[model samples]
Target: MNLKYLIFIIILITGITLAEETKQKAVLVTGASSGIGLKVTEYLIKSGFYVYAGARKEEDLKRLDAMKNTTSVRLDVTVQSDIDAAVKFVQSQNRGLFGIVNNAGVGVFGKMSEVPDKDILWIHDVNVMGPHRVNRAFIPLLKESMGRTTIIGSISGYVTSAESGAYSMSKFAVEAYTESLADDLRETGIHVGIVDPGAYKSKIRAKVTMFNLTGSYDLNQELTEEQKKVLNAAKERNNKLKEPDEVAEAVIHLMTSDKPKLRYMVAPTIGAAEVTMKTTLGRVVQLNADQQFEYTRDELVAFLDELLKENSSEL
Candidate 1:
């Protein structure tokens, strides 16, 4: 073949491949700056996805911009303008969004009495409303591709406890919204899933602690000895952060599978989802029709007792 003709053919093939990539495979990840979201973006790009790595900070998106087959986008899940810009980027590609990882969230740590309502609202704004905003903006594109949406929920949502009220409340709301969103979108051929992580290494725990320390809570307030012990334990547990790869892997699975699971338990430690999956609560979670997922205090305490025994036996 002539050198000129060979070069033309080569260019043509390259264009075709790029076009297919733009047309058939595109995913957007919010809060792609760090932690699980960053890993998910990286994993998807390596797996041949046309990834839109959405980060609020330009500095954080630098690595993603430097990568091939990836577009760095400004997306603050709480900001409508950012969501709009992201939608426009996807539209310009002419490829509908194939998947969305609504991975933006924040943490607030304090006892119920010490955590202010304003703090709780702030956490809810990001953890709960943020996903809703992103989902609302991207529904059209997602529908066009018949794509899937993965909301980053938490094990905290199901197993509420002390010193995590502010964070847990937001996740509880997210859990309900995720379920309702899934039910509403099911008939439209759009799939939604929730990944409730237990524990892993991330900046979130540190953030929670920092917020707690810097917060205006009355340190002069007296506390029972038991309260102080519980408080310290919460801080210590959060400080033990682990790698976020497991959560990223779960997100990838949700994005790639033809029929993704509605709930994925991707945690570094054993959690309510894992324990429940093998016990009676699992049946309740899988089979419940109503919005209310409830357990009496006594029942939950007993369940935890048995769960601990089971875990100890495994060791």
Candidate 2:
């Protein structure tokens, strides 16, 4: 090669390398005003990824935008116009999205027979349909970038107790949605996953309490003695619970890992994990009972071990 031509090639390669080194991946996180979403946003920023933090309130948008490498988008998961605007805004940035964390969710605790239909709908709108809407709107960009998408699920999908039917139902729906979505996108490079967190310190309970008592999101209303006790207990329990930083870590793994798992159950305690697993296994046992080809306990254990081995493989 001629000396001058070789030098020009060297300079061209160096410029390309510099450009690649400075490039940053962008991720959109819904419900980023507080709790898990906020933690994920902060951690992503710390890890040097650009973030489009989605929040509904004006103050939250301002706060998020003030962060380095962060842009706050006004996104209310239940509203289609807001979602469309968000999609447009993201496209306008021209960074091209790399990942999406569907973390916006709501919780309601009430008896199935007594909970108002509107309350159930409200929770479903935020918890279940929220992810669906956001996913549908952003899937084009995700496909363009071959990006990853994760929904923030809950172990409540597996273990439901009294007065948690609605919330549990929505989570169970998310579990199904994630599985089906993964299957649908199997050929695409886009990865789909869910992070199910257990009892992380969050504002979900406070919101639930306020909605259950006052039928609105307002927290300034007067409280009765019973309501006060409930709020106090919830506050105390939340203070005892750990932050959801691990859940944020799980999300980061899903976004960056070459071989990310489809499901990440992030429980705050071993007992919570055990209960959730047992509840899942109990359902399996129930399904086997009185069936034509019921498996024995040993057979089930062997099958579980086989599954574990398969999941451990680099597929």
Candidate 3:
């Protein structure tokens, strides 16, 4: 080849390498097939971070693969082998793993008394231990990068719903686990946080009302007239709810911040859950004079930060 052609080839290769190097940090987003997880993946890619998008479905993988610089992972957080495979895939990529969004979760609607043991067991496996599973598998990678970790939580973590017993139980467990994990990793360079979101237009809505996947305790069981009323109310309310962009922004902030709060309450409403948190945190924790019961995401996060700090210390 002539010198001019060789120079042109070198420039092309150099430009490609530069572009690749710009996305040096890769973040793993679980349950990335839809809803908040999908939105988070998109935001991260647009923000110029390489994303390892995890999904249990083939269609989700295909969609994520079409995006530039994203690795589509076949993952079911409850399954050990899937977690192992995802870790291996990230290893193959040779990119610096900067974070993991433990966003995979599901909800069920039933009274605590009526729900079967197996139902709660299955849920605990997914919502409670799932984050643990992902963390355990990705610890080495997270350690290498001193990465940040964010747990996608719910208002139910602190405030129980009248009908969603199994889901509330699991989320409460996740609440404790997130705090413990953060405390354990405090000394390490890695940062750990949680975002407890209220009603958001996500799969959780349909999962509870429509799909009803909780085998023994699901819709197959007959509902009381009261239960049906509650179901209808929830359906109506959730249907009218819009997807909370603030929730996604909150997660992204937690993942990317130089110094992130331990937890955030992503409720854009004066939710009943917020009321419970207010009372509990007020009694047990310090109060910020500027804080009040509110719908603003920033105020809620501030309120939660104080409460989570108290929880961590007690832990």
TM-score of each: 0.77, 0.91, 0.80
Q: Please give, for residues 261-304, the per-residue lDDT of candidate 2 as tens digits.
A: 89999999999999999999899999998899999899999999
Of the two candidates 2 and 3, the one with more favorable lDDT, higher being better, is: 2
> Which 10 consecutive residues of model 1 have the lowest summed lDDT?
213-222
lDDT of each: 0.79, 0.91, 0.80
When 1 and 2 are scored with TM-score, the better candidate is 2
Residue 120, model 3: Cα distance from true site in angstroms:
0.4
Best prediction by TM-score: 2
Tens digits of per-residue lDDT for model 1, 1-315: 999999999999999987776665888888887778887888888777888888876677787798787888988777788889888888987767888988888888767888777888888889899999999989988898888998888888766658888888998898889889999998878889998887776656545544565453333444567656655666577667777778888888888886688778775756545663554365554564354776665776788899789766643
The local lDDT score (0 to 100) that residue 260 gets in candidate 3 is 78
Best-first order by lDDT: 2, 3, 1
Clashing pairs for model 3 are: none
Clashing pairs in 1: 200-242, 201-241, 201-242
Of 2 and 3, the candidate ahead on TM-score is 2
Candidate 3 Cα deviation (angstroms), residue 153: 0.8
* Angstrom error at residue 282, model 1: 11
Off by over 4 Å in 3: 1-8, 11-19, 211-236, 282-315
> Judged by lDDT, which candidate is best?
2
